[model samples]
Target: MAGLDDYQFFSTLREKDNPFWQRTSDDRDRLEDPMDHYRRPTEFPEDLRNPAHGTPGPPPTKAPAPTPKFNELEGQKVNDVQMEKYGELSINIVSLCAENLLSHPFIVVRRQCQVNISSHRYHVLPITIVPALLHIQSCQGFSAFWKGLGSVLTIKGITLGLEDCLSKFTPWPKDISPHSSIKTIGQHLLLKSSALALITPFYSASLVETVQSEIASEKPGVFDVFKEGLTRLLSFTQPQTGRMLPVWLLVVPTVTHGVLQYILGNSVSTLTSKLLRRLHRNDQHRQGAVSKDSGSFLDASIRLQSAFIGHMAADVILYPLETILNRLHMQGTRTIIDSLDVGYEVKPILTRYEGFFDCLNTTIQDEGFFGLFKGFGALCIQYALYGAVLKFAQVIIQEVTLALVPPKPKPKIQDPVTPLAPSAPYTPSSIHPGISSLHTSPLPPPRTPYGASPATRRPLGYGSPGRRQDVDMRAELEKHKSSLALDD
Candidate 1:
């Protein structure tokens, strides 16, 4: 009796009269509930309603939920990302310094070679790298090789750091597509070129400091040299009067070099990467299977090599311009440089140029086209050594850093498993004692059609159309009884 009452109570809870059931429009309007903010039209003042039935009121407003705050773990993750970026930046700077330090001698040799000219009096024709290096060693000693190294390092480091910092604030585009429009490419090139051009004065100063012969009697500090270079760069005095070329003259060449170098380097890198990928794919097809680790390592190697190759190619192509630029930097500075020796006598620049094209024309006419690339061999050797040293240093630093501070392992997440309830075993029962118990399996549950639910499976008398008829339990029991009696 209690079980029957409980069932009746639950069944009644689904009826329209139950308070828990969803209210209809008319039923809600008829009710007078203080808690319900959506009041009936009659309760409102006449001015608020239409002439007949009032228009439906707007839905009740909801307060927005508070935003979730970052927890400690989330904050830690963000910090880690920032730290990683800083770490990579530091590593690159360190590697750059190391590379420069190791290969600076070659730089000295190259600059000297570039500035050296063949005169009829000295007959210093066919100036080569080995001879030039030996001459510097004999005359200026080993220390002369790094004469302007401090200025170079300072300029390069500051420029690299400043550019990186500014890049964050700059509205430079990211992840540009290969088929990007001309406008986008122009914007990218313009922005990058401008950044480089802005630092042209400093670069010119560094170049002047580099090409100037070391003064033994009164050695100037790095900062002093740098300041002097700046002073000379901004002065408009002629070469014979002993003043460096004006900084403005180098702007066009610097910007042009920056833009062209960027374009050529990227183009070469892209082509190299594509070629490598094609070869890799062909090899993979033939080999059938390759380990992911090996493939990833291969990709890293390819990128590093491609970048190196691109930079080298750009440098090679632009060597003439660089040589001319170096010469221009030394144009007004009448310092006796050890590298420009003809018959063991130091020589300074005697020619003056009006502009970049004028300098280009003068250099070609005076020494032929090949003369512009005076120290090509030294440049190549310097770059090769720099690349090798930079890579080695980076690897060593990263390995040591990892050894000192290993990465923390990620936390494992295990989902909660829901254990299903055990189903009861099937047992048949006889409907009638008179009929001998004939074993028969239980019938399968009725099939529910697609999109059908318990509400739609109610008896036909229910208000809903397209509803199924409910099964009659009593009729099914009587059918079983009749079947058993027939067996008897």
Candidate 2:
């Protein structure tokens, strides 16, 4: 069969009709329309016939009533739709705060880091804004800040809910539930990667270097498709180039964060747990939230713990990479504002390193490896604050949201088959509502008119205390007759 020509084999197989391999004639194949819209059968089978009269019988003695689909349970629906919407609004606010707080450290470090003119040997000094002045920011900066927060609330928020559905498929072990560190990092990767992709335009707009870098370039590469694509995306906007952030630059940190945590999480948590357990031998420590787990705060959630510890640790150890990435991205990226006019201005904030390794090598050669750790302090605060706000808000909001949402009432399901119909109609009682309700007649007690009670006593001829004998009817009649004649 494998070697035979297609025509020869197919023809032979088609012509052959051995009984074992043959197919019976089908009325369906003869249909004028092979793809007939309807398929209901025209013939009736024997089993389908009614047992009572050799034909399909009517429905059973009592057919079950169909249960109607309804939005409400019983007679009541969810009480407050407005309250739910309000809570949703507050949730968005919280998300914005969390996202901004998380990214502040990176922003501060990047803002301080300097750049040179394209291909220049010397580094330009940074225009340092006083700590308090960081509060005042560019219009483009506000755009990026709000965009990141909105992305977290809408895109990341929805993604988290969908991710929670993964739990519904299986009740995985404690190591794999929503609590697992590896699993949680994976969640972050999914969440952040998507969020980054969604708001890339805004991030690009926020960073002014993109346009500036593109302008200062002697030759543009085919790889600069990112800026070109972003320009198309923001075609409707006034300006597109310098006001934008690079997608890869923004995504790299989140991607790195997840991977680094995945690699370092188990070891760090294990060592931390062992150390926490050695705190005291008191019996009170035997059982409690803080007894065994290691986290950001005492007895805090593992997510908070992982984010705070993992992010800070990664920042410090890999702070050079962090700085390098920031510099790589921030070089020639700036958004300018003058008077009431808003537009993007090309300004190279860092020009020494064009790529990852270039930045890494340059930083080491010029400023030593310590240069990477420039924003370590601010970055640490950012990570720590993010973890605190995250965990604290989660715990508080969980309770608050729970309070806002009404709990589901247990169903009042009735047994369908068990008939418990009342024999009599209800009669209102002449009594208080809290007291006796239906005025049912009280039953009479058991007793008899005879001396002996009916339960234990026997008939007259039986062995009872009082029994009747035969009456002397003839003797009583003669005596009655004589007495009557004398009286007459």
Candidate 3:
């Protein structure tokens, strides 16, 4: 009986080496009943009691199925998945554009108008306006007016046209509107009133170029002399950027200027009016009313204030463009802002600053918050002149074009010039290429070549007649020299 008990007990134990036994043990440990033939016990005590008494289970079990590993992927499925993801990505980009427009129109406008200020002046306003205003304002005087106007119109038309052309390419979402009423107002101001002020720089730079040429006969290129002069100018102030004039460092001066103008406008006028009233008190008591001239000083002060503020606002608006363009010109890239690299990779000339916040941060980091406004005085002067030149050029060009183009007569077919054989040699004419050189001829109208009407030549920039290179060079030298003197 004891031997039988031992056999039964041994049979109950699993063979440790058997794979079937191991898998069975794993299943049991994992609490998996593969057969599903019996209900689980309610308690551990009941399970223990039934462990020996449960009907003898089938001998162990085979091992669980091995997991398969596949080497090849379904190329078609993968392509489909990728395509789906690309569509999703497109949707996301569209959504982002829409959301961004609704939430941040200022950012869009900011990209359009970058305010440029120098490093030497801290007190002046550093805000920079657009370029169109300069073109408009430059038009003035006699034959020069229409030419200048035409130049400005051309530039403005080109810029706005470019913007419109690019709008279609912008991948904005369905819900987004990059433009806003506020932005439109800002744009108008920037394109017109603000832009006019910035034309001065072209004239100023031209002037400087002129001076440089005059001096070049006796000295090195104006650039070299300019570098030396710039260094000398910086000797009085610590320059943050190696070659830049410390002109941008005087923020206080700019502030003082603006403040002075503001005070001159509103406060001065009010004070003048009050004083004038005191003087007129006796007159009022005698005549029951003061004369219109009683507040003449105040009236003059008010008028002066409006003119000063208007001129100042209008003047400095495009200073940033001038500053940027000048810096670029000095560095040798005249037409475009960026280098040949990707947009983000292109470094701005005045990378000494990133933005308004960056400037303020640098000021605080290097010399406290006060340093942010450096060069305000120089900026005001720089911007005022910069805008003036740009405007002057536009005005001049329009005027010139108008003057040059003769009034068109109704088209009539007259005797057209008869062409000689193709093998015939051409002869040069004595007529000069410019409108200024054209003689007023009383002779019958010249025969049209190929029966084509004479095309009216439009004015070029600033309504100035196209002169010989030597003449242009002389003018440029004179202008440069004048600017250099002013800077000194």
Give the number of the best model, judged by lDDT: 1
Model 3 vs truth, CA RMSD: 49.0
Name the regions of candidate 2 deviating beyond 4 angstroms.
1-258, 261-283, 286-306, 331-347, 350-354, 383-488
TM-score of each: 0.55, 0.36, 0.20
| Poorest stretch of ten by lDDT in candidate 1 | 435-444
Residues 431-484 of candidate 1: C-alpha lDDT, one tens digit per residue: 333322212213222333578888764322233222223434456446545555
Per-residue CA lDDT of candidate 2, range 1-488, in tens?
Answer: 22124334333333332121333365336535554445322334435776776666665466478887875653333444444445445544564576565664344333343322222211112222223224323323433322223322333444444445444554422123335687665554555445444444433333332222222333333334345435634553333445333455445663564355545654566555445445532434666534343322223333334444654565556555545555554544442211111122333353534456766787777776556555344454555567667666766755676686677678799878975654333222232233222121121222224687665543222222122243344543354455455556
Candidate 2 residue-wise lDDT at 165: 48
TM-score rank order: 1, 2, 3
Q: Note each model's CA RMSD in angstroms.
A: 15.1, 26.2, 49.0
User: Best candidate, TM-score-wise?
Assistant: 1
**Scored by CA lDDT, what does every candidate get?**
0.62, 0.43, 0.35
Candidate 3 residue lDDT tens string, 1-488: 22333333223331222221133555567656554445422223333544666765455577889887652345443543454444434433433343232212221112212222222223334343222223323432122112222232333444455444444554322122225465554443333322222222222222223212111123224344334434534443544445433433322333333334433444444554466556557758788876554332234333333343444453345334333333322322121121111112122334454333444455457554434333344345443444454344434543544454444444578998996544322222233333222221212232223655435231111222222122343453354455455556
